[model samples]
Target: MAHRIAVAGATGQVGREIIKTLAEREFPAADVSALASGRAVGGSISFGERNLSVGAVERHDWASTDLVFLAPGTTGPVTLARKAVAAGCVVIDVTGMSDPDAPVVVPEVNPGALAANPRIVASPVAGAILLSLVLHPLQALGGLVRIVATSLQPVSGAGKDAMDELFSQTRGVFVNDTATPEQFTKPIAFNLIPHVGGFGEGGLTDEEEAIAEDTSRLLGGVAVAATCVRVPVFIGQSLSVHASFDRPIDEAEAREAIRGAPGLTLLDRRDDGGYVTPLETVGEDPVFVSRLRVDPTGPNGIALWCAGDNLRKGGALNAVQIAEELARRGALRG
Candidate 1:
């Protein structure tokens, strides 16, 4: 049965991508509503042949919606989600902390988590999903015990404004214009900032803490230590992950596991700059993995690199996949 769906934050990059993904995957949505702030209510967005008029959540009828895709800037979706759920709509939250009781899901990694809880599912940050998609595959080979990850994140994660900042700054720098640091704490063009989210205790940024927490939760409680950096790139996210397993693992065994996993594409090559990079992975679905080797610094350490589109796989695509998972199991209710 086709469900009636509402996509909140419909004007943002990830929200727009969610609509695109839903249409591309042929999700069984009998009607799709695009939702945004009140100012966007009369605005319109294209969804295939239909031009969906953006509706203000303040006035939208939650009772008529079957599923709600919550991709609003972190805080915007909280109230709408509660109301949507109360109105009997299952919600797939993209970047918010949904009801604490709601399962944060990566469908490929943990579909069963939602089998019983159909009302709400939260999508972890793209960084967490990217890391889990690549690292979780090795669970069968003695399982992951600990992970140390350094994420080279793109400006897109910060939002559309950050992306604009990067572009305008880069252009400003080239034409002998001053690249101002406005949206970011520092100029993002032609530079790398080793800070994302606010700083937390123990010298870890909030983004790092989140990656650790979400990775552990998604990967069945494996400890994660993350250092998140904001790079100048416009799209895609890359992680250099050093994983320690409970048992000995060699390059061949690790490569085999990474290459064969779902939602991951092995792109490791030995020579001539053969490896996955953010530029090559933006707009792609599968997490492109490369640079697999046994870490020489420590025992039982397996190191690898991974990249995926921050907008798609990291945000919209993951959200869409969660919806698809719920629909496949007939968990979506109007």
Candidate 2:
């Protein structure tokens, strides 16, 4: 029997992509309900060949749903996910909110952890998800002691409105039209914003904080430092990661480890432009890594560049994958 799926934040970027990926994967969802906030009610989203109308999630009966995917939104996904779990549905959340009581999972990294959890799975952020895939093989080889990462994130990482704001601002400046910044603190067109989220006391943005915390939790280590920056790109995110390992790792061994990892593809032939750019990685599923080199300063240090579709493997696709896992484990009630 096919499961009944309900998607919260259905009108958002990741939510819409979740619906598309689910359909594209031919997931067995006998009843797929598109749910959003009250403001987005009555709207419609295209799910494959069928357009699903958005309904207010507050009015829906989640108890009858077999699975729920909560997209990133202002509404607390953790709270909603817990409610869905209490209602006996498997909850897969794209938001970075991790409950100490629940499991924060990246399927490729820690799919085993899900079996012990109740019913909710917290998806890591785009940067963390991509980083985990990049680091998985390295971690398996010798284990990572510390990592310094800098993310070049796109405006779409902020949300759909941020993408629109960048487009509108770019056109306004080019056409001499009045430009009003709504989604971002400053103009995003032809410029870079060092800040991606709210700043803390020490000047780290929330996005950066999330990367550090989420990476630690997902990797089962608390030794990663991250600096996140918003770039002019509309989609995809790139990361420059410098990792210190617990033991010596040769270049060939590192390459083989990364190449052999699941959900990751190594393009690290550094002879003649062997790398994956954000544009090349957009809409792609796996985390693409390139420019692998040994850090000369440390005996066990390596630096690499990685990229992936922030909306797909970073958010929506990961959520769908978790749902598939739950279904396979018989966690989803039909």
TM-score of each: 0.97, 0.95
Model 2 lDDT, full chain set:
0.85
- Cα lDDT tens digits, model 1, 1-334, are 9999989889888888898888888888899999888566789888877788888877889999999988856335677788988999999988656676678789889889988956879889888999998887788887788999999999988888899999998888878998778888898998989999988778989889888888888988888889989998999899998999888898898889887888999988988788988999877899998888988788788998999999998999999999888888888874
In candidate 2, stretches whose alpha carbon ends up further than 4 angstroms from where it belongs are 74-79, 98-100, 176-180
Q: Give the worst 10-residue stretch by lDDT in candidate 2.
A: 93-102
TM-score between candidate 1 and the true structure: 0.97
Error of 2 at 188 (Å): 1.3
> Which number leads on TM-score?
1
- The clash numbers for all candidates, in the given order, read 0, 0
What are the runs in model 1 whose C-alpha is more than 4 Å off? none
* Local error of candidate 2 at residue 192 (angstroms): 1.3
Which ten contiguous residues of candidate 1 have the minimum total lDDT? 72-81
